[model samples]
Target: MASQAESETGRPRYVPLCSSLLPLSRLTLIVHGPEHGHRIISPVEGCRRLYIRVNGIVQGVGFRPFVYRIAVRTGLAGFVRNLGDAGVEIEVEGPAGDVKSFLSALRDEAPPLAEIAELRVEERPPTGEKEFRILASRDGGEGGGTIPPDIATCDRCLADIDDPKSRYCGYWATSCTDCGPRFTVIGALP
Candidate 1:
């Protein structure tokens, strides 16, 4: 079943199950779970797309939530998702600085335990979407990767929470790719 790993402040997280089992089974279980929230979307005739990949202790942790916040802050346009191999993949659009800042933050200020081994970024045409998002993990064959542990909240997110009237004000579970929870739930299942 799919579950969440909350941040220190108690924000909902996207904790994916270990993919040692069959891909189809994992997909079915995760998608069927009650807590597996998805990005709401309205049908659009056209949109842009970008592809990015981040390798490290990203899975199970609150990487998706972190990415969501980063995407919003950078005025970027794209989606971020967890990969089966303990890594993160994202696609975004905006000014070059925004993309660079986003990537820089991945390592300079990542989740508490998120040890980023590598980051692969690529730029392509836009998908015509107005906002960024976090997407459900897709079945991409066997997953022999390791799962990271839960993480603590980042300082920046915490500061944002402390500042009233901020977009993330009172967002106790505020997180970015640099800080949040991970692997705690992986042990609870199977």
Candidate 2:
């Protein structure tokens, strides 16, 4: 028997049934009373997942570290990795709101040296991941994207070079993610 309660105007009210037992698709079903049945209830919120691909000058520009920092700050659990010369790939899973916020910050708060040509976002099933981390780089087939150009030394690196006690003091090639040469350096096979 359905439980009944007194309403404000002396009317009898029937308690709504629990919808969790039903399938997610059928959660909107209405259990009508003898008369009108216009009462609506909110659906349960669920976790969300997103697969993001960022292209153009993302590699070697502190993009992965930037993403990791944002994910940690936003309390998201996922992984970020370099997609070869193509760009970077990210998988973020968390509450829907947090996921959205993370995505927004990823675009708006990117590193200064990172040049984002395009950003693609796809929805996926939540994997219930517990932590966010940086993954190793992966090859993404042929036709790689443009390589990042050499950038001038940043203020921080300059400061480090000027500091007499710093290890990199007076070092000619001293640089960091935010400022460094990408393709200008010559290398020999070991």
Candidate 3:
């Protein structure tokens, strides 16, 4: 008889009864309970794919390059692209741990100019992608992302400006993905 692995909802889910249980990652057992809540246990093993759509001031803020850098660093495969609604779409597939890491980095290390109003992630089957890539922009539903406003000079840019040897020294318009006028420079929505 299979033992029970209960979820947060107290639903009885079945699992092999073993004296020594497998690590949480290996257990396909109960991760969450109830459709209303998350799994109570279990972390899906093997390759996992996540389709992430980030909304807000994501366009014209160097958000795509930031996503690309994190995706590559985490050893994930997939693509990141800009949406017509001033949002970003990222699809990443790799080991579950790596994918999770990518997600965390994406949230915690977003560009300074990007004010993420909403981030939605959905799990999907692997697509067997060879490498991470940046795809072209796509049209999206109406009225989602916010128009990015001009950002103040960040510490990094300030440091560069203060550096006597730097090329951007004393250059007032100096800006990168992180800080500077964004919405002001845009001719139109991307």
Best by TM-score: 2
- From the highest lDDT down, the ranking of the candidates is 2, 3, 1
lDDT of each residue in 1-190, candidate 1, tens digit only: 4446776867666443322222423333423224546542222212224577777666655678878887788677778877656567888765556667777776676666566776776656644455677888765623456566455786788889999878999877787655565455454421
Question: Of the candidates numbered 2 and 3, which has the greater TM-score value?
Answer: 2
Q: RMSD for all candidates, in order, please.
A: 19.0, 8.1, 9.4
Local error of candidate 1 at residue 63 (angstroms): 1.0
Segments in model 3 whose C-alpha atoms lie over 4 Å from true places: 1-45, 162-164
Kindly give the stretch of ten consecutive residues in candidate 3 with the minimal lDDT sum: 16-25
Assess candidate 3 and give its lDDT: 0.75
How far off is residue 183 in model 2, in Å? 2.4
Off by over 4 Å in 1: 1-50, 149-190
Pairs with backbone N, CA or C atoms under 3 Å apart (clashes), candidate 2: none
Model 2 lDDT per residue over 35-69, tens place = 55655543323457789988887877888989999
Please provide, for model 3 over 46-121, each residue's C-alpha lDDT reduced to its tens digit, 9 standing for 90 to 100. Answer: 5688899888888878888898999889888889998777778899987777788998898899876678888999
Candidate 3, residue 70: lDDT:
96
TM-score of 1: 0.52
All models: lDDT? 0.61, 0.75, 0.75
Q: What's the distance in Å from true for residue 78, model 3?
A: 0.3
| Residues forming the 10-long window of minimal summed lDDT in candidate 2 | 15-24
